[model samples]
Target: MLGELWGTGNLFRLALPDTFLGYFLLLIDIIFLAAILLHFSRKTSFNSIFEKWQWVLGLSLAGFITSQLLPIPLPFTNQSLTPFSVFPLLLAASFLNPLAVLIVGAATGLGQSLGQTNQLFDVFHFAFTGLLAALLLQQPFIGRLYHFLRHPIVSGSISMILPAFLLGLSTLVISEAGFSLAALDQSLYTSNNALLLFLFEGFINGVLVLIILKWLPNLRPRQTLIPSPTQRSLRRQLIGNFLAFSIFITIVVMAVVFNLSISVSRRLVLNQMAHNAAIASSELPDFQSELERLVDAFDNTTLFTSSNPVEAEVSLEQIYNSSLLYNQLIVVNKELTISAQYAPGEPEKLQLSEEEKLALNAVFTTNDRKIVTKNSSSVEGLSFIVPVMDDGETVVAVIGRVTQLSINNLIVGIQGVTTDGVGFIVNEEGQVIAHPDPTMLNAYWQDEENGRSLSIETNGIKNGAYQFYESKSNTRQLVYYLQEDHDHKWTVVVSTPYAVVLDLSLDIGRPLLIILLVVVIASFIQLTYQSQGITEPITEMVTASKTMAAGGNWTPSIHAQRDDEIGQLSQAFSQMQRSMKKRLNDLSLLLNVSSDVSTNIDL
Candidate 1:
């Protein structure tokens, strides 16, 4: 929305209205896809995009790599691939490189802005966030962040707030000073109204990147997978106390939530795909009518309708136009006379070899209607057909060929597959069309249940349901099914894991999981520090007690600052010291009493 406001007379066409938005967005999407494809191609051909310290770059590289190898082709072009921008920065911080972390953040924000829009501030919004992340990684005062994630303000209000304000300031100031398009920074700040929101989201993003960074090291084939778990000589035990029950309950609760999420995601995918399939299927009749109309026009203009050789060949040449999307649309008779409505880029000479001529003539004579596909080195199209016939039942001339739909759309719609999870598509053949797990499409994917394919009409179960099926890989697949008919019949299956389906209600699990992890780490650290505080006081008290018992004059010293359990120890130490002094005096008195008594009693 902000882009449109700034894009008024903008060069990148960013600020387009809805009517023209799709076109502009499409152009942007294509450019984005192209940039990704180029990136992927360069990485696959050259070397690993991974860097040891540059974790974000490695991940962006990995995401790009995965996208490159994803086998999900584009809608119009078969030669292209998609790159998801989320991974690289995730890799950057996760693996411990502050610089890469920043770079990844910048790249993702920049990529998002570029692909989805032409807005300048949008690019910098991402860039600014990334830059600050790098700065924060080294900031000396940001320790309390490592403490707990429940609140964002504790880790220095300035550290948390100032960066965001500056990011907005930079965008507005820079745009006003240099680019005309950058002045649109209002949306960025306004959306994240609170400083807490900014820091919480930003820091969480940073930590998320860190966690992903943790996993990437293991994923990297070149790097050693085993973590040399820091000799953290600490064997942790979940203590059997009040806390134990809470921990168990948390696990069970999470398990239930996970199961629920999977179920919901499955239902949503099925419902969506089924709706799309119904619409596509319904539109087929209209599409067919349009094709028929075009075919009728081509037939009347060409002389092949009369079976005249010379007239049909020469006259049809005049019937061709430059506006058509095809190079040629031809009507041929049994006599080999071709009346063709060729398009603008067509060669001047409309010549055909005997077999080529006969093949065309035979299609008119025999099949009544035949569809042939030929992608010449110069031109691209499929030979789509609806034969034009005469009243005598004998095929006189042919019309209706050459379609507008692209090959990539054909492959995806015709052969595309979705599974029981998000963004997954499965084809009629039960092959993985699109899935979150890359290996689900590949034969080697883990979880044997995932790789298995369930035939649609199985065990007398018809189509359309949230149902369970099995695959060749012995994986059980939960899928919502739909059939898509574009140029041909194809299955449009929407599926996610039953777990993912259920997870819709619990999308917060991501942040929660992060919070839980941070809590566990913080708890461990707190336990360590608390134990240290206790150890010194306890040790001093023990020493003082032992020294007094052995007849040594030991001064009492138990260091405890607070009036808690340790303070009680300090008070006890003082009492013990006084008691030791009194005991010494009593011993001396007893010696005198014994000496006097011994002399007197003997007389």
Candidate 2:
């Protein structure tokens, strides 16, 4: 989402650029805009240009304001429904020419990008949708067809559907969800709520346009007409509207609840990981204390400053035999030369390598305990170096414990790391000193050859979480790491596969889905029962009217029993039928009386 600006050494360095490609692309965009202007300038007349520009700029500003400040957040997804923002561009396409439409679209896109910090590609999405709308509404054949269907609602709704589809498709293409059905399905399952949001926005925008046109009749396009409602069955209309609104509400509610459940579950998992990291970090001081205690035992002995190598070796062997913590123990004199050494298998004295001697010299110079990994010699593992002093002033020798496996055991024994998770320790140099996988021991943590390259600051960060791709498992992992700033200066990292988080979310979502299903079923049944009450009386009236139209005697049988609107209608129908029958009988009687008088006159 970060926008790259072009910097120095570029042909057109507009700002402090992050990359040459971004600015070069900007230059190309400028050129393209100039070309579009040139093409439109000749075809578009300057007459009423100020009036047209007013509409373009005004609508663009409205669109920007609505997009930034008035977006309606949708439930169940991270997307906000911004149908109001699309209204202005759509209005432009309806009233103004294509040139104005394009300009307004571009300006609105720019403003939205500035407000939201969206990627540059999103601007194209807005512009393209606008152009599609313009073409649909302005092209001769389509425009005629649209006008032929004079109903404003139909025209507005149909105009929006294609543009909405284009916008959704563009969104999918620009994102990780390429041009694939499976990817789109996965995106809908995950976080891309926009796919449904766009389509919903289209229908909502259509209704919005209808309302606007009704309020401002002058804004309605020429040759377009709003027709009166047809005399359809009111019962059917009532039931249909009720069902539609109920279904819409049900979907929105379900989506919101499901997404909230997933979000809560994910947060719980993150919290658990953090708690585990804290617990693991709390145990580190104990490991450090154990190392300090081992060194303290040597400090209290005369083996460090003893001149006889045989005596020093005997003492070192005894200590090593008593404690299985270390594989090798050695004493180094002031010259950084090994004075005594002990290993379980090696009976003779072993000469120290130059690298080992330098390491010991560092410990002697610093006069402090240091933890290091020694891979330069056969006694490779984590080493603990302790400095020895004569009378607390002059340095005599240094004692070292090599191949201490206690730290490894401590890491492997840490609780709460799930079966699909791993916990390990890495030193300040980003070397994995202790890991469950022995092959990864002493391997550079950032080396791709070890499976994948990790770019985390293991030493600098105190505690944090990272999501990274683990090539070994070929899956994404969420890693929580804690750094302990002791003599060892090591980082403890615990990682669990991201799939586990999704699985947890699914476990939480299942119950929410069941609840939604039950609610929807209950609502449907209730609505069906309520609707029959309204429809049944209307159906009886419709049947009576049909009988009267066919010249049969018909009466409102239930008019006297009820006082609601249906009863009133039936009462009016019954009175009109009686009056007509009385008028017909009187006229027939008058005609017979006239006929008898004419017969008497003739006699």
Candidate topping lDDT: 2
The C-alpha stretches of model 2 lying farther than 4 A from their native spots are 1-236, 259-285, 300-302, 305-309, 332-340, 345-362, 373-381, 391-405, 413-415, 424-502, 529-533, 539-579, 586-603
For residues 1-603, write the lDDT of model 1, one tens digit per residue. 223321112233334223333344446544754564465466343233343435445555553233223222233211222223333433343333443444455455444444433444344344334434334433333234433321222222223354346444433343322322213323232223334444554454445455554665464223222322221212222222224554765677666655565455545545555555454444444444444554555455335565465665464455344223233556655665555445446556454433244446666657544434333333333444445556544454444334334322323332233433343333344544333343444222122232334333333322454433232311223454554444433344444443333345456455665676577667766766765676667667767778777867666565567788778878777776778777867988998999889989997
Mind giving the per-residue lDDT tens digits that candidate 2 earns over 1-603? 122221111132112223444445445556766776677678876564566777777987776655444555544443455656567766666667666777677765654555543545335446655666665555443234446543434444555454345444434444342434333433333334455555565557656766776888787456433321221556565666667677888778777876787567556766777667666667777666656655666655466676787887787777776666677787777776677787777787766655456667776777766666555535555677777766664355444554545755667544355676788777677888676665666676642222233333344546666665544443456676677664346677777766666667667777877877787778777877866776777777677778878988645443545688766776777887777678877998999999999999999
Worst 10 residues of 2 by lDDT: 5-14
As a whole number from 0 to 100, the lDDT of residue 313 in candidate 2 is 75
Query: Residue 73 of candidate 1: its Cα lDDT?
Result: 29
lDDT of 1: 0.44
**What's the lDDT of the predicted structure labeled candidate 2?**
0.61
